[model samples]
Target: MSKHQLKAVYVISVAAELAGMHPQTLRIYERRGLVSPARTQGGNRRYSDDDIELLRRISELTDEGMNLEGIRRVMQLEDENVQLRRELEQAREIALHAIREAERAGARGGGGGDLVPLKQAVAVFGQRPSIFDRD
Candidate 1:
């Protein structure tokens, strides 16, 4: 989390103002499992910058004429897409490291058949583009 996100200092009213949303709308978002803010010992809601950003995203999705379920699914897929991209990048990095290590070992000892190039070693999950990314 960023510093701003870690600091859940905004009360519901302040967060609503920052996100350009109503306090009741924030409450509804929380109820629908879109945003989760922290609660104080006194049982007041405290929102982080992350929550405010999510509210803004929700607002954008709504403005685009998407239903709540469609917005939820789009957000879920976006999260999954981001995660998968991270995982794929990590895998590619690992594969590159292994290829370099094998090349070094081969240069030292004349054995090079054990390792494969990155394109051959790694498998992409899906190349299909998202509807949101379509023209």
Candidate 2:
């Protein structure tokens, strides 16, 4: 099966069961906008493995005496952090791909072999000269 098909997405009831919480609590969380699940064409909620994990975290936080408002803010911050991490990972992969492509091109004896020096490249881009340089 493809990676998309392998995703562990479940209905609200199933997710509630997995997280050991009542379905009504899940609905309450949804109503509070704590977790936004994917919706079907019929507007039924679909919970992914990530959503279940977040629910468990919310449960844990609440059990520790955090109010719903505090939990909501924490969840929002956590979600933002997760998104930033994913973006950083994608950027790293792109940079690695570019490095590999450059190496291949350089090995082919094309003009690509004449890559600009770091300082020269920075100068070309109008950046200040390297700090290590003597006046």
Candidate 3:
């Protein structure tokens, strides 16, 4: 798993302490759907580092006078923004790779893929006389 995908290990009390909030507050946030901590095999809540950061963000939004619903909406928008940014980066990377492959194919005199642009794809590839030229 990636660093961000690390399993939750911090229990509620520790997570609350790390986030500088009361344990009860953490429970409230869970009930509010603000945070979704992982559950242990025994059905216990375990918060990860990412969850701690989320708790901090919740605290910030609350401090800024945003209601729980408003904070939830803001977080949803932020999550969408992050997902779009990541997808855009992946698309850019794919485009760059395609460009590089195209360049290499051109350097090899177009001996690469089976497909080509219609504008360049004459039915007769070699020196063949057209029907117009025939009469």
Sort all candidates by TM-score, best to worst.
1, 3, 2
Compose the digit string of candidate 3's lDDT tens values, residues 10-113: 98999999999999999999999999888766888889999999999999999999999999999999999999999999999999999888888887888756
Q: Give Cα-based local distance difference scores for all models.
A: 0.84, 0.83, 0.88
Local distance difference test, candidate 1: 0.84
For model 2, the stretches where C-alpha displacement exceeds 4 angstroms are 1-24, 36-52, 119-135
Residue pairs with backbone overlap in model 1: none
Candidate 1, superposed: residue stretches over 4 Å from native: 1-6, 110-135
- Give the clashing residue pairs of candidate 3, or none: none
What tens digits encode model 2's per-residue C-alpha lDDT throughout 32-117? 98877787667888888888888999999999999999998887898799999999999999999988988888888767456786
Q: Supply the TM-score for candidate 1.
A: 0.77
Q: What RMSD, rounded to one decimal, does every model reach? A: 11.8, 6.8, 8.4
Residue 12 lDDT in candidate 1: 97
Total colliding residue pairs, candidate 3: 0
Stretches > 4 Å off in candidate 3: 1-6, 111-135
What local lDDT does model 2 show for residue 49? Answer: 88
The per-residue C-alpha lDDT of model 2 at residue 88 equals 100
